[model samples]
Target: MRLLTVSALLLLLLGPGLALQIQCYQCEEMTHDCATPEFIVNCTVNVQDMCQKEVLVKDDGIHYRKSCASSGACLIASSGYQQFCTGKLNSVCITCCNTPLCNGPRQKKRPPASGAAAPNAPRVGLLPLPLLPLLLLSSTLC
Candidate 1:
């Protein structure tokens, strides 16, 4: 219950969604050396389950399985019960930083002007005392 309360408070205060994950995709097909006739490859940064794991993937003749890596260590792959490596397959991870990827320029958002405030900024003593109490109660209950 405490954890849920804290998570709820964080979601409300932080606005929404997880922060941007600055992933520099370095995978097999992500490299110049790797080109497979059998499969396609893609990668994404997932920040769920209290984990920051990198998902390395390989597609066999039939399907793809992510050989999940947690931070730096390799964990047992999801495609258990199958020995699915091939001579054509290339393993990709952070170590393969030389792997070529098309990255665009980073965008920076400038803050609003310092002297000006939002149009919706609360005016001093705008609401009467009774209304103020009601607003507080509503926010807490909400």
Candidate 2:
């Protein structure tokens, strides 16, 4: 019991001095659509800080941000921007971490169908090219 109390007291005394050193990626890379990150840089974080990975999707393009931020900022980053960015943004994802160099790029999540169309998205038209030629030939024969 005495040892437990002593240990707890020591922890209380030393806990305030113990701070974590975090490493994260720092860069702002933009893409027409959400794609793999193309650039990465090393950044050091402050004590009790967190690494932030954010995705900002707009009608024009998608942007990826990785940097160091405080825990409080991480919690309110999204909510704080909701008012002004509500309808402008298609999708937004902000992830926070504390480990060293843990802010590696991740696959960006695309917005719903209301967002930009995919590169290879199938075209929708009156008829298929082959069938259109066949129909034209059949009409000419008739």
Candidate 3:
């Protein structure tokens, strides 16, 4: 039947389209582990100004990325981080950062002590090295 043929064609063309979705390289937010990351459902990642911070808690972690379309039911890639989205938005860009996000007071990088500084930085106080505890105990005795 002509109707049947058209229906088959439509199904063939549109059925798989529904399975595609956008995937993030490091969606660490959805899944607790990067090995098995989770996705932000029914949402987009705003990569424009969120990549820097691993978890974009401000907007539920979902960005407005457009180029990332998957062949599944709208899924997001995770990398063990956390995120949140306040409303529905698409086409996002995230400003990724190798270090943790700037959450609080920043630790100033100390300038190398002129000549007084030792070649190798010593394991100063309360380190987790093998003999740190023993050294601490010895110092406490003094």
**Clash counts for the predictions, in order:** 0, 0, 43
Q: The CA-based lDDT of model 2 is what? A: 0.62
Segments of candidate 1 deviating more than 4 angstroms: 1-8, 15-17, 26-31, 34-82, 86-142
**Model 3, range 1-142, lDDT digits (tens) per residue?**
6555655665566554433233333433442323222332222433222222232323444322222222231233332222323233432223332222221123598887786657686856654343444455455555
TM-score of each: 0.21, 0.47, 0.19
Question: CA shift at 42, candidate 3, in angstroms?
Answer: 38
* Candidates 1 and 2, the one with greater lDDT: 2
Query: Which lDDT tens digits does candidate 2 get at residues 18-121?
Result: 54466666776646322234433334334337777777777777777777777888768856655554435676777787766566755477666767677699
Q: Give every collision pair in model 2.
A: none
Candidate 1: worst-modelled 10 consecutive residues by lDDT: 96-105
Q: How many backbone clashes does candidate 1 have?
A: 0
